[model samples]
Target chain A: EPEVTQTPSHQVTQMGQEVILRCVPISNHLYFYWYRQILGQKVEFLVSFYNNEISEKSEIFDDQFSVERPDGSNFTLKIRSTKLEDSAMYFCASGGRETQYFGPGTRLLVL
Target chain B: AQTVTQSQPEMSVQEAETVTLSCTYDTSENNYYLFWYKQPPSRQMILVIRQEAYKQQNATENRFSVNFQKAAKSFSLKISDSQLGDTAMYFCAATGANSKLTFGKGITLSVRP
Candidate 1:
């Protein structure tokens, strides 16, 4: 089965540095989303992208965060400046319909 | 707005036994979708089963089945003939007209040999 794929399975970055997490959603899926989970917390929605624009975002998705589908296949999340609290497992998902499929996830560590 | 709740934090079952994980959702929208995702020690999120609100017939995938009660706004997962591989954290989620998913805190299930 086709699945969402993400790059840089794990990343370690210095606080205040910028980081970009990349994802290649399932080719035919039209909607894409980003979610994060703190070490022991529930997964929190970050943003949703469709038609090259942000469709919805959570309060946690502040100015520091931005998502781009630079190419037809790549969806990337950029954090202008990383904070210690930003460290978590970031997941990328895509849906052809109501059922969305997830990637293995990228673990981000901002120290 | 939509919210999903998983009251049980953890559970354990003997191999080959049946286990049920509870999940409840509150949603104003009449049309929506509910899902159960499994996250093993690897931390990879995998879709185990899904139920559509309009479908009265529960959905069953292999040994994973869902008991969906639209009136009570409840959706629970039942795993039959549980195996050690079933050990994982299960999350119940719901999405409405808007495709953003609201997820519960998740419950950890351990299958004992």
Candidate 2:
């Protein structure tokens, strides 16, 4: 079965640094999304992308966060300045309908 | 905002026994979808089951089945004849209401040999 893939299974970055988490969604899926889970917390939606633009974003997705579908297959999340609180597991997901298939997730560690 | 609640934080079952994980959601949308995702130690998210709110009958995928109570906004997962491999964090989620999913805190299931 085709599944979403994410890069840098684990990343370590200093505070105030930048990080880009990449994802390759299923080729035929139209909608893409990003979600995060702080240790022991529920998964929270960050943003949803369709038609190469954002359809909706949560309050947590502030100016420091941006998503891009730079190519037909790549979906990326860029954090301009990482904060210590930013440490969490970032999961990239995609689907044609409502049920999203998630990637293994990138564990971002902001020191 | 729609929210999914999994009241049970952790549960355990003997191998080959049946186990049920509870999930409930709050949503006013007329149409939506519910799902159960399994995240094992490998940290990979796998779809265990899915259900459409509009459908009256529950959905089943092999040993994995859902009891979706639409009016109550409840969707619970039942794993039958569980095996040791069933150990994982189970998350119940709701989506399609706003094109985003609301997930519960998750329930950790441990199967004893």
Candidate 3:
């Protein structure tokens, strides 16, 4: 089965530095999404993308966050400035019509 | 708006036994999708099963099955002949027309030998 792939499985960055998490969703899936889980918290939705545009975003997805499908295969999430609270496991998911599949996830630590 | 709730924080079951994890969701949309995702110690999120609101027949994949009650807004996962590999954190999630998933605080399930 084809799975969503993410680069830099683990990353450590200094506070105030910029960080970009990359994901390659399933080739044929139409919808893409970003979600994050702080250590012991429930996974929170960040943003959803479709038709080359952002469909919806959560309040947590503030002005500092941006997502792009820079290429046919790559979906990237850029955080202008990282903070300690931004440390979490970020997951990328893609779906056709019914089910969405998830990537292995990238663990980001802003120290 | 949609909210998924998994009331239990953790559960344990002896290997080969049957275990059920409870999940209830609140959603205003009449059409939606419900899912169960598993994250083992490896920290990889895997889709265990999914249920579509329009389908009255529940979804079953291998050892995993779901009891979906559309009227009550309940979806529960039942694992039969549970094995050690079944030990993981299970998350219940719901998504409406917008396609943004709302996940519940996952429940940790441990399969004892």
Candidate 4:
């Protein structure tokens, strides 16, 4: 079965540095989303994208975070300045219907 | 805003036995979707089962089934003939008219041999 794919399975960056996590969602899906889970915490929604625009975002998705569909297949989440608290497992998901498919998350560590 | 709650933090079942994980959600929307996702040691989130709020008939996928109580706002997962491979972190989630999924704190399930 086709699945969402993400690059750089593990990312380590210095605090205050910029980091970009990349994902390639299922080709035919129209909606994409970003979610994060702090170690031992529930997964929290970050943002949702459709038609090359953000549909909704959580309070946690502040100015430091931005998502882009730079190409037909790539969805990227950029953090302007990484913070220690930003370290978590970031997941990318996509779905044409109500059932969204998740990718093997990218573990981000800002130290 | 919707919130998913998984009351159990951990559970264990002997091989071939049955295990049930509880989940509850707070949502006002009449139409929505509830899902159970399994995350093994690999940390890959895999969809185990799904139930549509509008459907009264519960959804089942092989050994995995759900008891969805729409009126009570509860959706629980039942795993039958549990195997070692079933050991994982299970998350219950819900999404309403908006597509953002609200996930419960996952429950760690260990299927013992």
Q: What is the TM-score of chain A alone in each candidate?
A: 0.98, 0.98, 0.97, 0.98
For each candidate, what's the DockQ? 0.73, 0.73, 0.73, 0.73
Model 1 residue pairs with clashes = none
Per residue, candidate 1 scores C-alpha lDDT tens digits across A1-111 of: 898999899999999999999999999999999999998789888999889999999999999999999988999999999999999999999993379999999999999
Q: Candidate 3, residue B64: CA error in Å? A: 0.9
lDDT of 4 by residue, A1-111 (tens): 899999889999999999999999999999999999998888999999999999999999999999999989999999999999999999999993379999999999999
lDDT of candidate 2 over A1-111, digit per residue (tens): 899999989999999999999999999998999999988788899999999999999999999999999988999999999999999999999994467899999999999
Native contacts retained by candidate 1: 0.60
Model 4: number of backbone collisions = 0
Write down the DockQ of candidate 1: 0.73
lDDT of 3 by residue, B18-113 (tens): 999999999999889999999998788898999999999999999999999999999999999999999999999998988888999999999999
Residue A86 CA displacement from its true place in model 3, Å:
0.2
Q: Total backbone clashes of model 2?
A: 0
| Residue A11 local lDDT, model 4 | 98
Instruction: Output the worst ten-in-a-row residue range by lDDT, candidate 3 chain B.
Output: B39-48
Give the runs in model 1 whose Cα sits over 4 Å from its true position: none
lDDT of 1: 0.95
lDDT of each: 0.95, 0.93, 0.94, 0.95
